[model samples]
Target: MIKYCIMILAFIVTGTTSAFAAETAVLQDAVTQTNINYVWTILAAILVFFMQAGFALLEAGFSRSKNAVNIIMKNFMDVGAGGLVFFAVGFALMFGTTAGGWIGTDGFFLTGIEGQDQTWTWAFFIFQAVFAATAATIVSGAVAERTKFTGYLVFSILITGVIYPVFGSWAWGGLFNGSGWLEGLGFIDFAGSTVVHSVGGWAALAGALVVGPRVGKYDDQGNPVHIPGHSLPFAALGVFILWFGWFGFNAGSTTVGDTSIALIAMNTFLAAGAGATFSMIVTWFQFGKPDAPMTINGVLAGLVGITAGCANLSPGFAIITGAIAGIIVVYASEWLETFVDDPVGAIAVHGVCGAWGTLAAGLFDTTAGLFGTQGFDPSIIGVQLLGIAAAFLWTFTVSYILFNIIKSTVGLRVNGELEAKGLDLHEHDNRAYPEFVGSDEFIEGEV
Candidate 1:
C-alpha cells in the first residue's frame, strides 16, 4: 500500500512540473519577441539611411564629371539639413495629434513624448527622418547641373519641413500618434508608393519645369541632344546598392519582427526581377540594343511600383505590376524627352509608376482585387484614384509655387557664365575630377 501511494504521488508531481515548465516557456517567448522587434527596427532603419549613398553615386554618375561634387553635396545635405528640419517640425507635422487629420499638431523636436515608449519613439523618428530626406533628395536629380545651391537648399527645407510632412500625415499619420484622412479612407501604400515617391516625383516635376533644362539639352529644332554621363559603372553600382537597401524599405514598414517579412522581401525581389527583364526586352526591341540607362531605371520603376502593393499582392501579381511599370517607364521617358528634360527620369519612375502601384494595390488585393473571388471592388479602385489625384494636386501646386518663389527671390538656375564653367568650379569652388573637366561636352548654349 505504501509503495502504491508513493507511485501515485510521483506521477502527480511529474505532471505538475511539466505544466509549470510549459507556462514558463510561453512567457520567455513573449519577452524574447519584444526584444527581437526592437533590434529589427533599428537594423532596418540603418539600411534605409544607407540609401543616401546610393542616391549620391547614382546622381553623380548621371551628371557630367564637373557636376559630380555638386551632386554629392546635395545628397550629403539632404541627410544632414533635412534630418534637422524633420526633427524640429516635420516629424510633428507628420505624426503629431490633429483634429482635422490634415496635419500633425505636436511632437516637435521629439519632445514631450517621454510618456510613451522612449526606445520605440527614437527608432521610429530616425526611420521617418531618413524617409523625409529621401523625398527631398529626389528633386536634386531632376534639377541637377543648373540649379543654384542656395535655391535647392531652400526647396529641400520646405519639402522636408512642410510639403512632404503634410502629405505624409494624410497617408501614414496613423503609423504614429496621428490619423490621416487617406488612411481613414483605407488607402493602401505599404511603403510609400504614393506618399513618398509620388509626392517627391510631383515636386520634382515642378522643380524641373521651373529650373528648366540644362544649357544645351535641346537644339534649335527642339530635339533632345544626347548627353551621356562620364561613368556608367558608377550608376550601375549605385543601382545595386539601392536594390540591396530596398529590402529594409519595404519589409521594415511592418515595424515588427515576424514571419511576414519573408513574404515582403520575396515579393520585393521578384518585382525587381520582372521589371529588369521587361525593361530590357522593351528597350532591345525599340533601340535594337538593351540600353543600360533605361534598364537601370526600370529596376527603380519596379521597386516604386511594387511598394504600394508589396504587402497586399501575391508573388505572381507583384511581377505583373513591376512588368507593367517597366513598360510604362520606357514610353514615359520618350514622351518627356520632347518637353521635360528630366536628367534622371525621376518623375516617370516615381510619379507615374507610383500612381500605377497604388492602383495595382486595389486591383491585386488578396480579397477585394481582381484576382479575388469578388473580382475586384470598384470602391477600392475609386479610393485609390482619389488618393493619387489628391497627391498630385497638393504636391504639384505647392511645389510649383515654391519653386517660383525661389526663382524670383534667390534665383533658381545658375547664370550662363556659371553654366558654361560648370557648377562645381564656380558654385562650390570644387571639382570632382579636376583632370578630366576641360571637356565640357554638353554645355553649348542656354535653352
Candidate 2:
C-alpha cells in the first residue's frame, strides 16, 4: 500500500509539471508571434511610407522643372494632411463597428479599444494610414502643375478622412471585427485593388476632368500634343522606388509572420517583371521604340494590377495578369489622351488597371476560380463586379462634387499666366533650381 501511494503521488506530480510546461510553451509562442507580427507590420508601413518620395520624384520628373518645387510641396502636404486626418477621423469610419453593413459607427478617435486588440491597433493603423496617403497622392500626379495648393489640400483631407474610409468600411471593416455587406457577399480584394487603387484611380479621373486639360496640351483642332517631362532618369528612379515599396504593400497585407510571405513576394516580383517586359515589347512594336515613360508606367500598372489578387493568385497567373495590365496600360494611356489630359497616366495605372485586377481576382483565385476543383463560383465574380462598380461610382461621383465645390468656392487651377510661368514662382514664391530660374533656355525649353 505504501509503494502504491508513492507511485500515484509521482504520477500526479509529473502530470502537473507536464501541464505547466505545455502552458508555458503556448504562452511563449503567442508572445513570439505577436512580436513578429508587430515587426512585420511596422516594416511594411515604413516601406509604403517611402512611396511618397517616389511620387514626388515621378511628378517632378514628368512635370516641367518650373513646377518641380510645387510638385514636391503637394506630395509632402498630402502625406502630412492625410496621416493626421486619417488618424483623427478615417480610422473610425473604416474599422469601427458597422452600421447596416455600409459604414462604421463607433471607435472614433480610436476610443474603446483595449487589451490584446490595442496592441494590434497601433501598428495596423499606421500601415493602413500610409495606404490612405498613397491613395491621396495618386491624384497629385494626375492634376500636377496647375492645381491650386489650397484646393488640393482640401481634397486630400476629404478623401482620406471621409471618401476613402466610407468605402473602406464596406469592404474592409470586417478585418478587425465589424462585417460589411460586400464581405457578407464574399468579395475578396486581399490587398485593395478596388479599395485603394480603384478608389484613387476614379477620384483621379474625376479631378483630371474637372481641372480640364493643361495649357498647350491641345491644339486649335483639339488635337493632342506632347509636353515632355523634365527628367526621364528621375522618372525611372521613381519607378524603381515604387516597385521596391510594392513588395511591402502586397506581401505585408498578410499582416503576420508566416511562410505565405515568400509566395506573395515571388508573385509580386513575377508580375512586375512580366509587366515590364510586355510593355517594352509592345511599345517597341507600336511606337518603333521602347518609350521610357510608357515602360515605367507599365511597371506601376503591373503592381496595381496584381494587388487585389496577390494573396490568392499563383505565380504563373500573376505573370499573366501583370503582362496583360502592361499592355492595357499602353492602350489605356493612349486612349484616355483622346478624351482627357492625364499628365502621368494615373487613370490607366490605377483606375482602369485597378478594376481589372479586382475582377481578375474572381477569375484567377485558386480556391474560388474556374481553375479550381470547385469549378468557378459565379457568386464570387458577381460580388467582385459589384464591389468594383460601387467603388468607381461612389468615388467618381463624390470626387466630382467635391472638385466642383472647390472649383466654385476657392478655384481649382492657377490662372493661365501662373500656369505658363510655372507654379513654383507663382504659388510658392521660389524656384526648384534657382540657378536656372531666369535662364532663357531654362524658361523656354527646360521649364
Candidate 3:
C-alpha cells in the first residue's frame, strides 16, 4: 500500500510539472512574437521615412538648378509640417471611433492609449504619419518650381489633416480601432494603393491643373517644349532607394513575425523587375532611344501598382499587373504633358498605377479571381471600381477647391518674373548653385 501511494504521488507531480512547462513555453512564444512584430513595425516605418530622401533627390535632379533648393525644402517640410498635422488631426480622423461608418469621431492626439502597454500604438502611428506625409508630398512635386511656399504649406496642412484622413477612413479605418464603409463592403487595398498612392496622385492632378504650366513649358504654337532634368544619375539613384524601401512597405504590412512576409517580398521584387524591363522595351520601340525618364518612373509605377495586391496575388500575376502599369504610366505621362505641367510625373505614377493595383487585388485574389480554382466574383470587381471612383472624386474635387482657395487668398504661384529668374534666388533668398546661373534659353540650347 505504501509503495502504490508513492507511485501515485510521483505520477501526479510529474503530470502537473509537464503541463506547467507546456503552458510556460506557449506564453513565451507569444511574448517573443509580439516583440518581433513591434520591432518589424518600427523598422518599416523608418524605411518609409527614408523615402523622403528619395523624393528630394529625384525632384532636385529633375528641377532646374535655380529651383533645386526650393524642391529640397518642400520635401523636408512635407515631413516636418505634414507630420505634425497628421499627428494632431489626421490620426484621429483615420483611426478613431467610427461615425455611422463614414468617419472617425474622436481620439484626436492619440487620446485613449495612455499606459505602459501601448508601445505598438506609437509604432503604428509613426508608420501611418509617414504615409500621410507621403500623400501630401506628391502635390509638391506636381506643383514644383512655381508654387508659393506659404500657399503650398497651407495646402499640405489641409491634405494631411483633412482630405487624406477622411478618405483613408473610408478604406482603411479598421486597421486599428474603426470601421469604414468601403472595408465593410469587402474592399481590399492591402498596403494602400488606393488609400495612399491614388489619393496622392489625384490631388497632384488637381494641383497641376490649378497651378498651370511652367513659364517655358509651352510655345506660342501651343506645342509642348521638352525640358529635361539636369541629372539622370541622381533620379536613377532615387528610384533605387525607393525600390529598396518598398520591400518594407509591402511585406511589413503583415505586421506579424511569420512566413507570410516571404511571398509578399518576392511579389514586390518580380513586379518591379517586370515593370522596368517592359517599360524600357516600350520606350525603346516607340522613341528609338530608351526613354530614361519613363523607365525610371516605371520602377515607381510598378511599386505602386503591386502594393494593393502583393499580399494576395501570386507572383506571376504581380508581374502582369506591374508590366501593364509600366505601359500605362508612359502614356499617362505623355497625356498629362499636353495640358498639365507636372515636372516629376507624379500624377501618372501614383494615381493611375494605384487604381490599377487596387483593381488587380480583386482580380488576382484566389477566392475572387478567374485565374484561381474558384470562379471570379463580379461583386469584388464592382466594389473595387467603386472604391477607385470614390477616391478620385473625393480627393480631386476637395483638392481642387482647397488649392483654388489658397491660390486666391495667399497666391498659389510665384510671379512670372520670379519664376523666370528661378524661385531659389528670389523666394528663398538663396540659390542652389551660388556660382552658376540658369535661364530657360540656356537650358533649351544646352549652352
**Lowest lDDT 10-residue stretch of candidate 1:** 438-447
- Summarize candidate 3's per-residue lDDT along 371-420 as a digit string, tens digits: 76688788999999999999999999999999999999998988787787
Q: Local distance difference test, per candidate?
A: 0.89, 0.88, 0.87
Candidate 2: clashing pairs of residues: none
lDDT of 2 by residue, 1-447 (tens): 999999999999999999999999999999999899899989999999998899888888988888888889888877898889988889888988888998877776777753337868888899999999999999998999888988999999999999999999899988875678888888989888899999999999999999999888999998899988888888889989999999899989989988899988988898888888898899999889988898899898889999999988988899999999999999999999998888888999999999998988889988878686567888888899999999998999999999999999988988776788888887898888887753212364444
Q: Where does model 2 exceed 4 Å of error?
A: 114-116, 438-447
TM-score of each: 0.94, 0.97, 0.97
- For candidate 1, list the clashing residue pairs, or say none: none
Q: Across residues 391-442, which tens digit of lDDT does each residue of candidate 1 receive?
A: 9999999999999999999989987768867888767987787566456733
The TM-score between candidate 3 and the true structure equals 0.97
Model 3 segments more than 4 A misplaced: 113-117, 441-447
Candidates 2 and 3: which is better by lDDT?
2
Q: Model 1, residue 50: what's the lDDT?
A: 87
